[model samples]
Target: MAAGGGSASDPLFPPRAFSPQGRACLALGSPDGRVRAWDTQSGRLRHEYVPSAHLSATCTCLAWATGRPTKEGPQRKKRKSEAAESVEECDLLAIGTTVGSILLYSIVKGELQSKLTGGHDSKVNCVRWHQDNGCLYSCSEDKHIVEWGSQTCKVKCKWKGDSGGVSCLCVSPDGKMLLSAGRTIKLWDLETKEVYRQFTGHSTAVSSLMFITERPSSESQPFDGITGLYFLSGAVHDRLLSVWQVRSERKEKSAVISFTLTEAPIYVDLAVSENKEEPVKLAVVCRDGQLHIFEYILNGHCKKTITSTSIVQIATSGKDDGSVPTPIPILAVAFCSDKQSLLLVYGNTLQPVIERVSLKTSEPHICLVRDIQKNLTLKMKTPILKVKTPVVKSETKVLVPGIPGHSASVKSGSSGTPVSEGKRKPGDKEISIEEQLGAMDIDSMKAVRRGGLPQTDSFAVLLVQGLESNDKNILNKVFNTRKEKLIKNTVARLPVYSIVPLLHELTTRLQGHPFSALLMVRWLKAVFVLHASYLSTLPDLVPQLGTLYQLMENRVKSLQKLSRLHGKLYLLITQISASETRQDVTDVNQTAKLVYEEESSDEESEDEMMERDSDDNWEEEEEREEQDVSADKEINGDSDPDPGEESEEEEE
Candidate 1:
């Protein structure tokens, strides 16, 4: 989907909620009052629930109840029955709406269990579950933060200090302090219900605030030295993001980590890694539909900025460490205005592109490594029968244009007979012209292409085939080949989608041909080798590989249970060959096409066509109408002067 684009004045404000499981995101719609749950990993909507309990009022905020274990005690007969009636172990979702009401819904059974009213005089802006205490806290524009218990909706405590309405509210990690920002920030003691501190840094109304804990100390000691808990807040008028740290010095306590903004940040979200080694990263959603991720250091330095388009909300979850948090942080989720949601989990890795370049004679070769882990696993369970591993003939010839009289032979290895290397015999039909050209002028081919000449190399085409056997020896042999480097190089330069075209081309090239296990094995081995090499260059690719590896492992188990040894082997080989071949071809074609098109397009200029197309037809028509109307007015004025005006002029 295309990312959303608009001026800052027309900013979209969709209600967003974080899942209690931290595995998904919920996008709440206004007026229509529908809540849609989206899977974080896939960015797809999992389910939509519109509780009958919240029919008219729009849901403003949502919070998931953190299931805390109950205290241990002896089970009495009456108590057990009462417990069953009063408490049900289910996922509870608390939703605050526009009509000054709070609705608690049971998600497991998909039903609204309870409704509470009269807590807030105005619309509830935000709601959060307190981790330390089992109660829920909610703040509204009425300048009050009300606490609610399990059955009653009565306000346990009301924090009212700000002159303007409260725009945002958050509870500290320890749950001892509650922070609210409106025109100013007010810190309230959760236990005592007293205003403990007033933060007067922000010049304008504060939009959002979050509490973050730093990475744990290295020594096997508690985080006593880290008494200061940091808070990130953003302002609407100034578009500035400020970081404040609360620390105790001697007997007195103060808030630090103060900063100002260079640009106006509308929506701000903060995430501190739990890993302790990674730094705290803040994802800011700006009014301009731009998302910026900043790495915060202890000395108040902004280390790096990662920007994206049309990001509405940003969240992070993971180990509290000071490092570059992974794409799948321990916990991270971002909501986009474009109907899609992003979830950052614990183990997401980036995919790598592979490029194939010949090392023999300085020729640029490119191929994409296709991940066939899925297909391979399926084959492992249903191997093809009577399939022998085909011998890979290293005699494969590559044709290179622009470089004359250069020949290179790719050698293939098999268990039985090996073809002797020698000069090509006269009138040999098996050796194609393209192959001869590739073998003869590989270096010149690379040089000419590099020199902006048209490419005529056909060896760049990728061929994928499936193996019919699951022999470890075959797999080892296929992966342990010279083409391994080529495959690796190609895959590193291509995306997953580009590999599809290459696979289609290969299937067409080898029509009606019997499946060869050896060839398939060779291809699979080359692909695996390439992926392994690319993994080193792209650490983000690990998550993708991990997913494939898991699938392969599952297939192996299924094959063992089904007792389809040969079928499984065949399936594995075929899938591997097809995947690798498709990916390689797609990568080469895309790269070459892009390079070729860019070079070729500059030769011609279409100034006349551009001029003709640039004419504003709508404006021209309007101009013609205006000219005609002005001429009519001029003709009318000349044809007849006003009698009253003429008489007045004569009298003067």
Candidate 2:
């Protein structure tokens, strides 16, 4: 129901890897140098397995074994039944690590059963288990894809066909073909150990590859017999995703569909609905903070597009009852039997943020779900453990010298006055400024303090800090000031009720942080100016003002940074002025003065002359326009042109 509900849980430690059974998520971080299991639904810890032999490394990828043993003998039937029972019974996790090692863990026993090492020269990036055979496949930055036997963790085959490092690897549902995507898509015949075909449509490196399966024809038919597998590959530079169909003979591949996106996806994972009833949908996450869902139609067409913030991985969990198949006789429905989809998003920032989107609903809520059991309980216990706690640290009030303080004045040229210390008896509480800031829970404030501006002072201090930081090129002070002005103008033109809550939030949560507060104040001022200037022409101002607001809301932390604030503010003001909102003339002039002051400090005489020449060109354009207007009026008095004739001439 809410925007971030599904992401309310804690992020998976060291990220996560999804199995075919999406209900169980695997966390491969070195929590005591071991791989752990996490239940996705309940956010509970399932198990933890540590292979004592494998130390000083982190697991990077994981896959579940789905293959059956191919041994033949008199004990075949009993062995098959026993294998089926065992395979269906216990969950298996295959882990790939930075050391180019693969470890197979038994979920029921919570122990490592088998380990494979040195197959890859570099870090393994992806791992997948063959559906029909007890075999494991992995791709690494070493530019190799190595297949291993499930029991021994022995390399069955190794394919090094890519020029660049292999980024992703996938196996066909039938286990006949393996696909490795890197600079291009390379297809390998698992049975023959031959590189059959190479597809090269991507301009950039390929990040992921998936095989979409067709539906079974009847209950009696085997899954591989009924369904045909097709490949979907995602590329980075071109921002192009291509769908290819393998010929029935399995010798060649044909490109059936392709689509371009605004951003190049870094890591693309796919999920297919298990219900044979619904249209095919593909979820893609791009590097440019966008999550896209594409619905496939007949004749190789992608009909719908939905976009969101940066999504890193996507996986499906079986089927649901709501996806009824339309009877339009389109493409064959191939469902993965999984009911839901898990999307791992890196968020707008580097902080890893994962979101689970339910295909059952168009508007999905994002919650920060934690895979680790400890975090899940912590999340649940956080609100219920109602305990009144007192601040344990006393606040320190610093009094600068020459500020006319009643006491604690420092001599000239000496270090500023020391903060007054107070002693509290046992049980008396005190709080620090850091603790107070933490309680506010404002994301931008956290960023600002982390960037070295922990103390808050008056507006003058803010301005000075902004100017000083501009030297580091971290803050664009002029643009930020202009942006703040725009926000202020927009808010002023809004109804009183609309502005009150924002102002209240600024005064309360943002207390003591005068720099951030001043920025907000300036934004409100700019919004007011824009609204007033375009009050009679609201239609034209609406879109531009909306863009400005959206930019501000999205870049909250960057706006709080004093260095870049002024530059961003000035740019916003210029944009607004260009949009016919002729307001804040004096403020604009002051901002210009500040910019000149900053830029003038570093310029030769020739550079200054060039800058002056550009200004003169602008002035000359305005003067020439005035002269042309006067001349046109004099000519019109001498000879008036008929309106109809002018219209006809223009049309002609």
Candidate 3:
């Protein structure tokens, strides 16, 4: 019931729920520990239970219970006064508080009926009532689950299930089995006063639990004695809902099925669909201000397969134009009495309201092709024919560069050959590769050398030629295609006079091919090292170095921004991971891994902070010394021995 973590817009008070008897009224809790019941149809307040200032505490959980009849008698007509008294006796609301006390308030009287205290030592996280037995079960941060008799307001049974404190509890309809979840999930047998079953596989603390029973055809009838023992457990941190089947015998393996959700769910409610085929529907109120409804079919073996899902976007604080909208987290969700609508409670501490949403939508129907005919055949009735058409001669006009004033017209045949050449005889000579290479010019030779160099000397030859050549296209091609492992050695082979053009080429291409920017940076460092003495005092290189400096400044700024964004995403992912499956101390046999958790509420002592500062300063000094040594090596033109390839295949 922690609702996990949220921003300022998230509701601060406890979550709400619809009444179990009729669900006509929705119960909402306030920050001041008051309970308000609102009519689901009219959206009006029906009852408000306000406590005294001394007994006031933030409401943490709410549960509704109808008072059981003291005795059974034959049905007979009653006067108006007797019927009104009966209604007042039946409606009761139980509110759990941060002080670990439970307040039972009569809805008809709009006042507290009884206060049950000294049951839990810590904050109560959940409270559930068993209508059949008139017993209330409550779990708290003190790691204990207490069952109190409603009439006596005293603890009937007390037991501990988890060491990390229980956050949620669910009572079986028959009051035989109890479900408790916190760091782990455990099932208890209320009658035997012992553990019934212990379920595993949830990597996070369970937030809510509900037994999925087969709803009867008539709403007036009670659940067919829990026709199915399947139940759902939701974990907010991991955004997962797992369905577990409780086996009647201890030896049978209980199957666990899980469904992943897009956002963390604060509350989940199940509704029985009117359609017989799709008998069950699930409603989930998520932290992103959206309502998700899942309609599924439950098989005989206790397996549920989702047939369809609908997502309703709830308007919180957004514009119609759809900009970046602020999310107002939903606090709770429940199905109305008719099961044709849903009620949602959302908003911040200042002003929270309940809204009703219709459940009806266009039902999807399958198109079935039922008719089938054997021996079906299709025959062509018309004969096909081939036709020959006359060919059209196309003329192309070419502008001759040598004769600028005159254009030449050329006619081509259907076979795509020039009409002037006519048809070539089979005996005519064909061109050879040797003739083509021999007739090539200087520019043609450069094009062949780009991709035609032998594997052995391709990188070395290209690097030297690219550096010496004035054309940037050749240099860029060489830089982009050269093997990364040979960069240091190949740059070392460049002549001292080619350093100026190499710097210019690297700087120019840095902006054009951003993917290769890091490779270019490495090349620049290598060039500066190889020709440090020859190029350091040359004033001709100053303008190029200034441009390179500016480019590097921009690159550094972009990387810094990316690093900050990555840190924020890492923080959120780690928080979720910690909440899901974290331990106070790892076992000795466990493998070492990175575990991220929130810092404690207590601030660091002055001595500890000072020590941390000193350590950081020492690390900074060591890094500076390392950088200085590397710079000295570069100046002395030292080459790394057997440097690994950096995968420079990325080219744009």
Going through the candidates in order, what is the number of backbone clashes in each? Answer: 92, 70, 2
For TM-score, the strongest prediction is 3
- Report lDDT per candidate: 0.53, 0.54, 0.67
Off by over 4 Å in 1: 1-11, 42-44, 51-56, 68-90, 219-226, 250-267, 274-277, 300-652
TM-score of 1: 0.41
Looking at model 1, residue 327 earns an lDDT score of: 29
Task: Kindly indicate the candidate among 1 and 3 with the higher TM-score.
Answer: 3
Give me the runs in candidate 3 sitting further than 4 Å from their true place.
Answer: 1-13, 53-56, 68-89, 215-227, 249-255, 272-277, 300-308, 316-331, 345-355, 360-652
Residue-level lDDT of model 3, residues 1-652, one tens digit each, is 1122221112453457677655667777766566678776576777777777423466778887877544548878889998865664466788787778888888766678899998998778888888687889999989999989998999998888688889888877566888899877788888877887778767776777887765555667655343456678887576667777776554233445655577777778887544336657777766565666776665544354343366665443445798654555566667776777766666542334567766554433211111112243578799889765434345544222222123333434344543334345476554455543332222435535554423544555676676666656666666765555577887777776677877877888787866887678778878877788878767356675888889889878899899999999999999988976766656576765887667773666889989999999999999999999999988888846445543333331
Ranking by lDDT: 3, 2, 1
Report the alpha-carbon TM-score of model 3 versus the true structure. Answer: 0.48
Query: After aligning candidate 1 to the native by TM-score, how far in Å is the CA of 266 from where it should be?
Result: 5.0
The TM-score that candidate 2 achieves is 0.43
Residues 401-511, candidate 1: write the lDDT tens digits: 343323433332232222333433354435555654443435655656556444433123222222223334543343334565565564454444434333332233233
Which candidate gets the maximum lDDT versus the true structure? Answer: 3
